[model samples]
Target: MSDLLARHRAVMPNWLALYYQDPIEIVSGKGNRVVDAAGKSYLDFFAGILTNMIGYDVAEVREAVERQLATGVVHTSTVYLLRGQIELAEKIARLSGIPDAKVFFTNSGTEANETALLLATYARKSDQVLAMRQSYHGRSFGAISVTSNRSWKNNSLSPLNVHFLHGADRHLTQFKGLSDAGYIAACVDDLRHVLATAVAGDVAALIAEPIQGVGGFTMAPDGLFAAYQEVLAAEGILFISDEVQTGWGRTGSAFFGIQNHGVTPDMMTFAKGLGNGFAVGGVVARGDLMDAPHAVGLATFGGNPIAMAAANATLDFVLSHDLQANAARTGAIILDGLRAAAPRFPIVGDVRGKGLMFAIELVDPETGAPAPALAARYMEETRSLGLLAGKGGLYGHAMRMAPPLTLTEDEAREGLAILVTALENIS
Candidate 1:
C-alpha cells in the first residue's frame, strides 16, 4: 500500500470512503484536468464532487481571492459589516427568484440546510418535515433526519419528524412505465396521502432536492415539485429547495434546478460551486420567513471576505462567459453519447441527468440487480484510463459525471470517450 493511503486509513474514519483500488493524490489542476502526485493528468469528470464549477487555474477567481487577502482580514465574522459579503448577498437575493429574498451565508451545504431547518421549524411552529425517499441533504444531526438515503443516514434518532415521500423514481417504482403526466400525478397523490396520514396537515416544511445528488442523480418529472408545492402551500408548509448540487445552471434548462418546476420555493439552500472549490454556502428565502427568528443567528465563518470574493468572481465568470448555455450544448452531446452506448453495455441499467450532471447505473447483467461491485470496477478502470468519475446511489451502483460547467466540447467528448471505454472494460 502507498504510504499516504496507509496513513489515511489509519487516521480517517472507516466511513470516510475513498475511490479506486489505488487512489491518485491530485496535487495540482488546470482547466478541467488534475495532475496527481505521480504526474498523471486525468480529465476530472467529478470536479471534486461538483464543487469546482469553473475548474482550476481560473485567473478571475484566484485574483479575486488574492485581492481580498492582500488587505489581511480574512474573517471578521458576521458581527461586522462587510462589503464583499453585502455584494454577494445582494447578487444572490436578486438571482434567488424569491420575492423579497434575504441571504444568510454558511460555510458548507450542511450548515445552509441546518439554517433552513431551524428557520422552517421555528416559523411554522412544528417539527414535522417532509422529504423524499432516496434524497440526501447533508451529514448533521438535523440534516440527516430529513435526508432519506439509507446508506448516509447513520442515526436512528432525529430532532425533526421527517416523513419520507415517494417523490421520484426510487420510491415511485410503481409509477414506472407510466407516461410523464401519469407518473407526476401518482407522485402528487402519494404526497397528499403522506401529508394527511403522517403529519395530519400540520407539517412545518417539505424539503426537496430538484435533483437528488447522492441518490444517483435521481429526478422526477419537471412538474412534480410544482404539483407538490401547490398542496404544501394550502397547508402552509414551506418548500425548501436544496440546491447544493443542482444550483447555478447545472441543470442547463434553468439557473436554479427548481425553476424548471415553474414554482418559486419559499426557501432555497446552496453551497457547492459558487466559490469554485472554496467553502461558501447560504440560504435565501422570503424576507418574512428569513426574519422569523426572534434571536440573533450568526455563523463565525459565514460570508468570510475571502470566500465571498471568490464567490463573487466565480458567479461573474459563470454568467459573463455564458457557461450555463455551454452546459446545455455540451451536456446534450454527452447525454446522447451515453444513450447511444448504453445498449451495448449490459451492466448499464440506465442513463439520466441534464447539463453537466449525469449518471449511469450499473447492474448485474443477468439479474439486472444493483451492482455496486461493477460500479467500483468502472471507477477504477475510468481512473486508469485518465478519467475520474463519482459514485453514489441508493445501493451505490451509480457512476456520476458532473464535470465543471466550463467544460468545452472537446473535453466533453474526450471524457465521454474515456467513460465509454471504461464501460466496455467493466461490462
Candidate 2:
C-alpha cells in the first residue's frame, strides 16, 4: 500500500480524487468489468458514472480510434476544417432529430456545460440562472453557480446570480390539497414568480438536468416541462438541458434527456456515453441559439480526430445493438426485483429510476427517514463480496446503479442478488 501511495504521489497530482482508493491501481477494463493492478476484477455497475455506455474497451471504438490515430491529424481546433469533426457533428445532429442544431465539442462534461452557460448568458444577456435543487450540472464556475447542490455553492469560488428553483422542496411535504400535476404546476409557478421578482431584468436561462441523474435520478411529475417552458418562454429565458449524465441511451430513449419529457430545450449538453469511455463532450443548440455574441469558445482539443472517431463509432454501436431497448428491458427487471425484495427488508425505502439509470434509497427501518449510514454499510459490504456499488442522492442514502446498457439479464440478476444479500446482512 505504501509503495502504491508513493508511486501515485510522485507521478499524479492530489486533484485526482473521487471514491475510496484502496491503492489498487486500475489497469484495464473490458465489457462491463474493470481490473486493478493486482489483476482482481469487479463488475462495473456505475459505468464510470454512466460514461462507459457500450462497456469498456469496446473493439469497435478501439478500431475507430486506431484508424484516426494512423491518419496523423489529431489536434485540429475548430479553426481549421476537419473532416472527422464535421462528420461527427452531422451524425449527432441527424440522430438527435435536431438537424438545425449546431455542435460544439469540449474536453469533458464541465467544459460542455460551460459552453452552454456562456451561450445562454450571451444570447439572453441575463445574469440570473435558475436551476433545481439536488440537480448537478458541472463543477466549473458558471455551471457550479447554476448547479443546485449546496456543496458546490458552499465552496467559496462560486459566482453569484445563480438561484435555486425549489422544485424538489415541495415534494418533501405531502401533497395534501393538490394532485401530482398540481404540485408540479406549483413548482413551475414558483419559478415564474422568482423570474418576475428576483430575476426582474437579469434572467439569462433556466438550466435543468432533464431527469436529474445525481439528484436521486428523480423523475419530475408529469406535465412539469410544459409548465416550466411556458414560464421561461414568456420571460425570454433560454432553457438549457444539462444532459451531461442522462444523455445518449442511458434513459432508454434517443437524443437528449428532454426527449423523454417531449419538450425541446433551447440547448442541451451531452457527455459521458457520447463517446463511451473516450474523452469528449458536446453542446447542441437550437438554430437561433447557435449565434454566439463573440468568440467565447475555442477549445484546442475540442474536436480532435481521435475523439470524433470514438464518438461516431459509439453512436453506431448504440443504434446497431439497440442498447436502448435492452436498457429499458433490463431496467424493468432490476426495478421489479427491488420492488419484490423491498418487502423482505425493512431498510429498502424506495426504488426509482428510468431505463439503465436507477437507484434504491435506504431508509431508517423505524422512522423511514433517509439512512446514509446504512447506504455506506451496504456499499462497503458489497465491495467486500466482489460487487462494486455506487452511492448517490442529495443525502447520500440512495444506492445508484447505472451499469453498461449491454449488461445482461443474468448479470443484473447476480448484482441484485448481491444487493439482497447485503440488505440481509444489514438486517
Q: By TM-score, how accurate is candidate 2?
A: 0.93
| Residue 210 of model 2, lDDT score | 72
lDDT (0 to 1) per candidate = 0.91, 0.79
Write model 2 residue lDDT over 1-427, tens digit each, in one string.
Answer: 5697888788997766545535456688978888877777888788778888888888999999999888786777878887878898887777666648888888898898888888888787866788887888877777777776664454655554777875554447654467777788778768877866776685888888877766777767546866788877876888888888877777775445678767788888888888887899988887667766666557799878888899999988888998888888887888888888889888988887787888888999999889999888888777666677677778888888888989998888887788788889988
The local lDDT score (0 to 100) that residue 179 gets in candidate 2 is 73
Q: Total clashes, candidate 2?
A: 0
**Candidate 2: worst 10 consecutive residues by lDDT?**
167-176
Q: Can you write out model 1's per-residue Cα lDDT over 1-427, one digit (the tens) per residue?
A: 3999999999999999788888778899999999999999999999998999999999999999999899999889999998998999999899988999999999999999999999999998999999988889999999999888778978789998889887667433577578878887888888878876767547899999998999999897889899998898898899999999999999899999999899899999999999999999999999999998999778899999999999999999998998889899999989999999999988999999989999999999998989999998888899999988999889999998899999999999998899899888866
Error of 1 at 401 (Å): 1.2
